[model samples]
Structure formats: C-alpha cells, structure tokens
Target chain A: MTLLEDILLLGLIVTAVAAPLCKRLMATVIVYMSFGLLMAVLWVLLESPDLAVTEAAVGVGVTTILFFLTLRRIHELKGTKDE
Target chain B: MSKKESAWTRFAAWVNGEHEPAESRLFSMGMGPRKERRPEITLPKREEKQRLHGFLSWYPVASAVIGVILVGILLATVLAMPSFGQVENPTNNEVPAHYLQHTREETGASNAVAGMILNYRGFDTFGESCVLFLAVSCVFILLLRDENNTSQKDLEQAQRREQRRKRRQDVILQEAARLLSPFILLFGAYMLLGGHHSPGGGFSGGAVLGGALILYASAFGQDAIRRFFNEKVYNTVRVIGLMLYAVLFGYYIFTGANGLENHIPLDYGGLILPIDIAVGLVVACTMYGFYAMFTRGEL
Candidate 1:
C-alpha cells in the first residue's frame, strides 16, 4: 500500500480508539466527527465526489450541529439536576 | 462427666422406645443448627405441569429439524458457487455509453453530476423533495398539537411569572441575532437559486436560513418569531411549493416531453426551474420545521 493510505489507516485507527476512550460526552462526539471527516476524505480518494460532498455536508455539517445542540440540551438538564 | 453420661443415656432410651434408630438419627441431624433440612421432593400434582413437560420434550426435535435445514442450505450454496461465479455481469456498454457521450451537448451543463440529477433523473428528485416536505409537515402537525391551545401560552405564562419575580438581563447577543437573521435568509435564497451552477444548493441554503431563524427565536423568543412567520404561513408555503412541482411535472407530461426536460430559457443552463424552486421550498420548510421541533424539544 502507498504511504498516504497507510497514514490514513493509522489515523482512522487512532480515531476509532480515541472516540471510546474520551471521557466527556462532548469530546467523544468531536472524535466521532473527526472520524466522519476522515471517511469523507477516504470517499474522495475512492473517486466518488458526490458521496464525498454528501458526507461533508450531511455527515459533518448538519449532523455535527445537531449533536452539539443535543449535547448542550443535555448539559442544561444536568445543570437542573445539580440545582 | 457424670451429668453428660446421664443425658446421653436418656437420649438413647427416648430414640430406642419412640422411633427406628435410623429415623431417630435423621431427626437429630436435621435439628442440628449447623445445617438446614431440605424440603421433601414431590411429583407434579397438576395435569398442566405434566402437559408442559411433554411439550418441552419436543424442543430438541425442533432444533434438530432446523439444524438439518440449515445444513441443507449450506450444501446447496456450496454446490451453486461455480454457477454463481459464472453468471455474466450485465453490461450497459451500448446505450449508456452512447448516452454519456451525447449528454454534454444535449444538457449543456459542465458538471455531469448536475446534469444527471437535474436532467436525467428529475422526476425522482422531485418526488424525493416532496417526501421531505411531507415528512416536515407530519413532524409539524405532530409537534404543534391543537392550534386553539398552543404551547406558546404556557411559555408566556412562565415568562410572566419569571419577570414578576426578577428583572431579566438585556442580552446583546439576542439583539445581534435579530439584526443578522434577514441577511442570513437572503444568503440562503441566493444559494438555492445558484445551486445548478454553484457549490451551494437548496438543502444547505434552506438549513442555514432555518438555523438563522432558530437563532432569532432563541435570542428574542418563540412568540416574537411566530408573530412574523406563524404555522399558517409555513403550511401555506409548503403546499404552494408542492403544487408548483406537481404543475411543472404535469406540464411536461401533458406536452409529451419527458419529465425534467430543460424548459427554462437560460444560455448554457441545465437546471429546470421547477426542481430548483421545489427543492428550495421543501428544504426551507423542512429546516424550519426541524428547528421549531428541536427548539421546543419535542423530538
């Protein structure tokens, strides 16, 4: 395999490991987002521009925003619990 | 030592006179504190229990039948492997290749993806966009409940009670959001219109616009946003968008032209107006509906 492919594979492995290892829920979500971003890059490399665009937009952009929003809501509920 | 011997003699006399020696020993052992007596084992008294046991005895038989069937399937798959491998890959070498070669001149679009989506498969795109609209409408209906008694009233009451108890902070962030919302909406529209030739499209643009509105609502209040663009207005726009798509497709069919045929008069344009407009409207409504549901925490 090419050096670039090997490097990307290593990065993906790290992301996979780190996602579960992250303690905070928000940090875990960020790691998952990075995983998705990497997958988009992989899709582009595989010569599927349409899929890449979709992954970047729906997977990374909209879904990440949704996750962040939900996380914030969870944080608010946690605050209420603390009170 | 004499008292202990006397007690043992008395116990031996009681055991010998009252019961069998084995029974007497068992009783003594059972009464000892170090161990507890086991309950007497009893046979099933109910007919139902006997029937259940009979039924359970067939479980192994059923498992054996399933296992045999699975083995048969596995053998069949193994035997069929060569035939499956020998099956020809269906080729569209003649028509699709010719179509691909002729597409650029016919569609007048630089991007093959855009041409394929907007021109070749326009009907499917229209249907998909309509599905999005339908989904958002259903979500809206499910979330909003009866209009006569809206959730806004409860929110208003809560706000009033909070205001009565304490002074609310004058947030500058809210004020800035309110100011920026219109520009965001305009940019979203531009993205929708320029989608055929540019990077941005209906879905992205609509989401951005809807997000901007959500920001405004959160900053000011739901009631404030509702005053300008209420449920009725959104519903109307959604219906209008769907109707426009239907009309466009209907026109194409009636005129004996294929659906998604570029009828729009633009120099070097591949976009049909109906698709762009329909997608834009659907995206906008969907995004808005999602935002409304999300902010209200219904989903």
Candidate 2:
C-alpha cells in the first residue's frame, strides 16, 4: 500500500508540474485532471473515501466539463480556429 | 459636460487597465486638472526597451527559482511536522472519541463522518449548500440568455450551431449515453439515500447525477433536456431544494438550542435522509445548471 501511495504521489507531482508547462490548453486541462485523479487515489490511501469520491466527482468530472466548455466557448477548440 | 473624475471612477479605470498618467500624485490629491500631461524624467526609449527585453528574458529563470524555493520551504515545513496518524497526535482528542462513541446513538448514522457533518456540525454543511446555491444563481445572472440580454446576431449564431449539431450528431456518444446513464443515475441515488450508512453522501451523489445529466445533454442536445427540465422546472427545483434544507435545519437548530425535545426521531437517522436529499438536489441542479448555462447560456 505504501509503495502504491508513493507511486501515486510521484504521479501527482508530475501531473501538477506538467499541467502548467503544457503548450496546448486542452493538454493542460487533461494533465490537471490526471492530477485530480491521482489526488483522489491518495485520499483513498489516507482512508478518506468521502473525500476521494468528492475529489473524483468534482475535481475530475465537473471541473473537466467546465474547462472543456470554456475552451469551446472561447473558440479554442480545434477546427473552431478557422471560424 | 465633462464627467467628474472621482476616485471610484479612477480606480475603476485602473482596474480596467486603461492608460493612466505615469505620475498621478497631482490628480490623486484632487489639486490639478485630470487631463493635463506633464513631461517627466525618463530613460531613453531604446535603452528602456533593451532593459525591458533583458528583464523579460530572465523572467522565466527567476520564476523557476522562486517556484523551487517555495516548494522547498513547503516540503521543509511538512517534514518538520509530526508524522501522520499518530496516537499521541493533537488530532487524537477527546472530541473525536466522543463523536465516535455517541454518533450512532445520537444521530443514528452508521457513518460517523456523515453524522458529524449532518448533525453535530450541520451549519457547516448548510453553509456549503448555500454556497452552491449562490454559485448557480450567480452563473444564472451572468450567463442566462433572454431577449433583453441576447442580441439578434447571437440568437442566429446559436440557431446555426444547434442546426449544425443536429446534422452531425455523434451516434456513438448517444448510444453510450443511453447504455450508461441509467446505471449512473441509479448509483447516484444509492449514494444519496445510503449516505447515513456509507462513504457516499449528498455532494458526491449529486455531482454524479449532474455528470450523468451533462452526458445526456451533450449527446442529445438542448431540446430533449428542455422537454422535461425547462427554465421553470429548473428554477423551481433549485429554489425549493435550498429552501427545504434551510427550513428543516433551522427548525432542528431552534429546537435543540431552546432545550426542547425534538419531535423528529434521530433513531432512524430522521433528519439525515431529508437533509442529504435536499443537498443532493441543490448540488445536482447547480452542476447541471453550470453546464447548461456555459454551453448554451440558458437552462
């Protein structure tokens, strides 16, 4: 369990750093989402399943949709650039 | 007629990033005319531009060093703190013990965390619900489309987009949504209703429900969702959910504070179910409302 946690923690750090450094907004959002997912796993490891559930649902799910919508609305999505 | 330039208007202009005088002491002290331009000492423009370029070139390295230092400081702080989940830790107080021992009996919730949040520290949860409610209300105010706010060109553009979406709908998304939404909704209902006894709760469950709603909406378009959850129904559900939780929790607090024997029984987790449902309703609506408003500027 500790080993798995360590791996997840490392992944979290990587995703956190990569998110801001990503060139494309979509990639940044995706990396940020992976960070959320890793944090959810860490929450479960910490024995806070409630937090894990909320993190997965809110941090990963709703937040990603909102980000995508914002991207689309701003005409940042692919193929919308020409328009 | 020249507009009177008060501090408020000047501050607003500053916030909007409008061009301002390099030295505004005279204008700020209200002693000089606002429009007067004064020549002041300055660096040669070419030299200043070179200096700016030099600073800009070093900005990334400076920021990276600062980031590393900040991270090191935070890590050091965490390392200096005691290790996690120690028996003698400050968090292992009598308060947690008391909650653990009495939660099941007092709140009839098998889940101590749920009992604590929904019963003992209910006002915190109430405040959270209010925040979600307020968030959706703010989004509605900012994004809701109507004849007053939406221009004719915007309406036509939206119509064109809708038609385009209809013409090139993704069959796979619609089919997958049809296959998966029922199970997702069922799981959400289970989480909401079983919150008193399990790890799941109102917020998580409502978010799941909202996710399912968004998926269906994305697959099928606005017309299908509007058939059932039009503006009127959405408003009613959102408002009523918050009101229900507020009234019920307020009654509970009033009775408890006044030292009266509450009419509701805590044995069967009397208030937990209703409160959870109310919270779930608010959250689900808030999530869906955000998605709908963002996508179409209406619900």
Candidate 3:
C-alpha cells in the first residue's frame, strides 16, 4: 500500500509539472485531467471517499468537458487530422 | 523646419519662459486635430528585433520553468508535512471528536460528514448553494443569447455548423450516451438520496447528473434537450432550489436559536434529505448551466 501511494504521489508530481509543459492545448488538458484522476486516488487512499467522488466527478468529468468546450470555442482545436 | 525640429524649438522656447507654456497651441499645431495627431512608431533595428523575437519564442519555456520550480517548492512543503490520520496531528482535535461522537444522535445521519454539512453547518451549505445560483446567473448574464443579442449571420453560421455536425454524426458516442445516461442518472439520484447513509452527497451526485446531462446534450444536440430542459424550466429549478433551502434552513435557525421546539414532526433525517436534494438541484443546474451557456449560449 505504501509503495502504491508513493507511486501515485510521484505520478501526481510528474503530471502536475507536465501539464503546463505540453506543447499542444489538447495534450495540456488531458495531462491536467490525469492529474485530477491521481488526486482522486489520493483522496481515496486518505480515506475520504466523499472527497474522492467529488474530485473525480468535478475534476476529471465536468471540468475536462468544460475545458474541451472552451478549447473548441476558441478555435484552438482546429485543423486536427487525427480522425 | 520639419515638424520634429519645430516641436523641439517650441519646447526650448517654453523652457526659457519666453511666453506661456503654449500647451494647447503646441498640441493643436499637429497635422490635424488632437485625435488624428498620430505618433510615428519606429521599428527596432535588426539585431534588437531578432533579440525580441528570440525572447518571445523563449517566453513560454521560461514560464514553464518557473511553473515547475513553484510546483517543486509546493511538493517539498507538502512532503514535509505530517502524514495522514496520525493521532498527534493538529486536526485530531475535540471538534471532530464531538462531531463523530454525537453526530448520529443529533443529526440522525449515519454519515457524519453529511450530518456535518447538511445539519450542523447547514447555513454554510446554504451559502454554497447561493454561490452556485449566483454563478449560473452571472454566466447567463454574460453568455445567454436571444434574438436581440445574436445576429442573423451568427445564427446562420451556427445553423450551418449544426448541419455539418448532424451530417457527420458520431454514431458511437450517441449509442453510448443512449445506453449509459439512464444508469448514470439513476446512480446520481441514489447518491443524492442515500447521502446521509453513504459516502456520496449532493455535490458529487449533482455533478454526476450534470455529466450525464452534458453527455446527452453532446450526443443528441440542444433541440432534443431543450424539449424538457428549456430556459424557463432551468430558471425555475435553480431559483426554487435555492429558495427552498433558504426558507427551510432559515426556519430551522429561527426555531433552534429561539430555544423553541418544533411543532412539526419533521426529524433531523427529514431536514437533511430535503437540504441535500435542494443542494443537488442547485449544483446540477449550475454544472449543466455552465456547459449550456458556454457551448450554445442558451438553455
């Protein structure tokens, strides 16, 4: 369990630093969403399932959608050939 | 003399105190009126321009470096803190002890957290609902569009975009949304109603409900959602949810503060359930309202 927590904490730090470093806006949003996922896991490990659920829903789910919508609106996601 | 030389001569004359400052006169002596007196902007030399462009290209990298350093500092600070759930931790105070010991009896909630938020500190939850309400209202003010605000060309462009999307409909997303929305909505309701006895509560459950709504909206388009969740219904739900919480919690505070027992047979569990539902409604509306206002600018 300690090992898993250590790995998760490391992942959290990596994602937190990598999000802003991503060149593409899409990659940045995805990295940030992953950071949220790791935080949710941390919350669960800390025995606060209430916070875990809220974090997953608000952080990973709604906020990511909102970010994608804003990106699309600003035309930052245009001309992608990635079918 | 050229314009620059004459302006310099006028400045030297003014410094000598030969006459009045000639502020208005000198300003009016430009090519035309004050508004049209444009200053000549010279571009930087080649080397300076190159340096500026290089700096511009490196700005993002510099900011990213600063961000990483800040994150490192924060991580170091967090790592140095006490571990979670330690008995000697500062958070292991009498306040939590009291809440854990007496929450079930006083609030009739199996979940101490739900009891804490919805019963003991219900006014705080009510304030959060008000914040959500005000947030959606602000978004509506900033983003909601109607015939007056939307232009004909914008409407045409939107229609064209919708048509293009309809032409290239993502069948997989639509199918998944159709298959999943019902279960998602059911789980959200369960979380909301069972909040007092479970780990879930209004915020999470309402967020899940909002996520389901957003998925359905994305797959089925605005017209389909507007059939049931029109602007009128949205406004009514948001306003009614906040008002209900305010009135009920206000009554509770008044009665409790006055040291008067309730005439009604409503128990703590009943009060918590209603407040949870009210909060759920406000949060669900806020999430969906933000999505709708951001995307379609109408709901």
The model with the greatest lDDT is 2
TM-score of each: 0.58, 0.87, 0.82
| Predicted complex 2: CAPRI docking category | high
Look at candidate 1 and tell me the lDDT of residue B241: 75
User: Alpha-carbon error at B135 in model 3, in Å?
Assistant: 1.3
- Measured as a fraction from 0 to 1, the native contacts recovered by model 1 come to 0.03
List lDDT for all candidates, in order: 0.66, 0.88, 0.86
In order, the interface RMSDs are 3.3, 0.4, 0.6
Chain B alone vs. reference chain B, TM-score for every model: 0.55, 0.84, 0.77
The candidate that achieves the highest TM-score relative to the unseen native structure: 2
At residue B201, candidate 2 shows an lDDT of: 82
| Descending-DockQ candidate ranking | 2, 3, 1
Clashing pairs in 2: none
CAPRI-style docking class of model 1 based on DockQ: incorrect
Tens-digit lDDT track of model 3 for B1-299: 69999888878776554545646676444565457667887777997899899999999899889978998999999999998789999999998998898777666688989989988888788888888888888898789887658999888877887897899999999999999999999999999988988988889989999999999999999888999999899889888888888888888887772224554333546577888888998999999999999988888
lDDT of 2 at B158: 89
What's each prediction's clash count? 0, 0, 0
Runs in model 1 deviating more than 4 A are: A1-13, A16-24, A38-56, A68-77, A80-83, B1-99, B145-187, B257-271, B297-299
Clashing pairs in 1: none
For residue B132, model 3's alpha carbon misses the true position, in angstroms, by: 1.3
